[model samples]
Target: MPEVTPQQHALFEEQGHVVIGPILPPADVARLRQAFEAQAAAWAAEIDTPLDDYLAVVSQWTNVWEHNPVFREQLYHQRAAAIAAELIGCQRVRVFHDHLIVKPPHGGSTVPWHRDLPNWPVAEPRAVSCWLALDDVTAESGAMRFMPGGHREPVTRSIDFLNEAKVWGERERDAVPVAVPAGSAVFHHCLSWHTSPPNSTAGWRRAYITIYLDATCTYDPTRAAWHPMAGRVSVPAGATFNEDVFPTLGPGLSAAHLATLRGGAA
Candidate 1:
């Protein structure tokens, strides 16, 4: 497993994102890719014909934990979970959700720029997301692009799913395109402004993302839950945190890791 460095922590604090390389070995990456492909194929068969066809051919989908234990296990994978723990400054982090964004060759549309927090049912601002590359991601292959330090800005008015340009302003100068090799990972704040271009390549561009909420983060049950699996673990509105919802990932807890879980640190 790749150890989180102080430099990485500092970069995350300053820029609201960081990239860690070689988090998964080649064999593990292969396993995850196979699992994702299998799940995607199964999902395609369940939804209505054309819609399922579209999803199978040209869109993104998530929340496979309900159907596959392998998908759930991938979310809590020891190395990836450890990285998430470090990113959120928590010893324990809940598997908020898992997402699959597959861009078919020459077909997938661009994902709009948006902050994940606004879309989430939780009120906590410290949640983190790890986007693992399942294939070589490049600018033409629909790699994620993030606006550096955009998370610190005020939350803009939320827009409907159809209006992509209206939802996010033009890309800023500090916006960086993350082109990661398969098996690497990019860690970003939940509030970070990010988007991806359409896939213009010849093969599918696939990625698996697992979102994690710090144990100290509070939940708002009133907000519309994005997934049925989301409500599976719920903490009261004003509660400091819930361990049953956000379990620890490492060998043991410590000041750095436990602080966030107890609502004592960032």
Candidate 2:
């Protein structure tokens, strides 16, 4: 597991995002890619779209861990979660959800600039997403560009991907594209303004993103009533997330605490 050094933590606090160098080795990366390919094939088979067209379509699947064993393990990746916890400055963290975004070579569309917290159902903005790249990412290959310190701004409505309108006025000039090799990851704040351009390269751009919320984070449907994952919530508004769905993780968390997290008797 790679540690988020103090300097790196400072950078994250300052810029609202920071690149964590390679956490997975070549073997792990290979296994993840294989799992994704298999799962993608299954999804393509179930859809009416032709396989060729389906592969070309930019794919965004939420909670793949619910069906894919490899992705299930990835959801609990200690290294990634630890880094997320460190970035959020929380003692413990829980899974909000995981999503897989794949931009196929040549045909993917651009994602408009937006802040994540405004689109989530959480009551607080204490969350971070660990975006692990499954392929070499470059500016020309749908790499994420961020508006540094944009998280400090007030939250706003989600952006329409079909529109090319710029939301962050003068701050757009300060946006920076972050490129990383396969097995590396970049963690960004939930409120950070970010976007990615369409892939123009011959290679695919795949990213598995796991969003971790601070343990104290509570559910709030009003934040995003139509959020895709909102239906999975079993807790009342303003209550802590259910551990069965959002497994809590932390350093030196006791067995009794784990039981409590699961809403069970310790």
Candidate 3:
């Protein structure tokens, strides 16, 4: 399948998002789900909690590429990489991070609507995330909801979840639910305001999210962006992604790597 089409690019630019179905074949999806379950089980065991009773898990494996070969493989997958390249108009992109969000049955929690860039240390405004569904996601099962053109809005005051009323503002008119099937993926701009409601269904809602930023994207360390509760981490204050945080993984793409590859820089 073509990694990206002109129509897809246009849609992303206009709507600030795009959804692609079956981006991961059946086998690929199965493998990823297996990996996620294993990781989740191990994590739950360490925390002295029952795996089946967890509410919402986020950012379990920070540097996933270092621990899981499957994650490493996915980071360099041609389809994902190509799509990211096209979306960011970069010659090469690097894996910013990977997160596995699992909402267990009867998990009642709302991920407040907010933009990721405000939470990240990256200055690049072009980063994108691919939310790959490992299971069928529905409105009742905590499927992601996004506001159209939300990315265009200026960054608002950061929300403190402790104060629910203070954090969640009035819902925008363009906000809509995004229901995706297994093996499908939703592409969203980093600045898009989005969130998911609680999963009242009996089954788990599983999603594998990977964020990609162009190698040339700049970093902004003022936000002190780091993993949740992990404390501050090292990142260049004003350099592009490649100069500091993002590491190159693919082979034989060095020339294309320096210049944004998607725009034919190589």
Which candidate ranks first by lDDT, i.e. highest?
Answer: 2
Candidate 1, 264: how far from true, in Å? 16
Query: Can you write out model 1's per-residue Cα lDDT over 106-180, one digit (the tens) per residue?
Result: 868877777788776677787889888989899899898988888788766444568555333464656878898
Candidate numbers sorted by TM-score from highest down: 2, 1, 3
RMSD (Cα, Å) of candidate 2?
5.5
> After superposition on all CA atoms, how large is the RMSD of candidate 1?
3.8
Backbone clash total for model 1 is 2
TM-score of 1: 0.83
Error of 2 at 214 (Å): 0.3
lDDT of 2 by residue, 72-175 (tens): 98887888887776677666889998999999887688888888998889989999999999999999999999999988788777765676566667767899
Comparing 1 with 2 on TM-score, the higher-scoring candidate is: 2
**TM-scores for all candidates?**
0.83, 0.90, 0.83
Clashing pairs in 3: 90-261, 90-262, 91-260, 91-261, 91-262
Q: What overall lDDT, based on C-alpha atoms, would model 1 receive against the true structure?
A: 0.73
Best by TM-score: 2
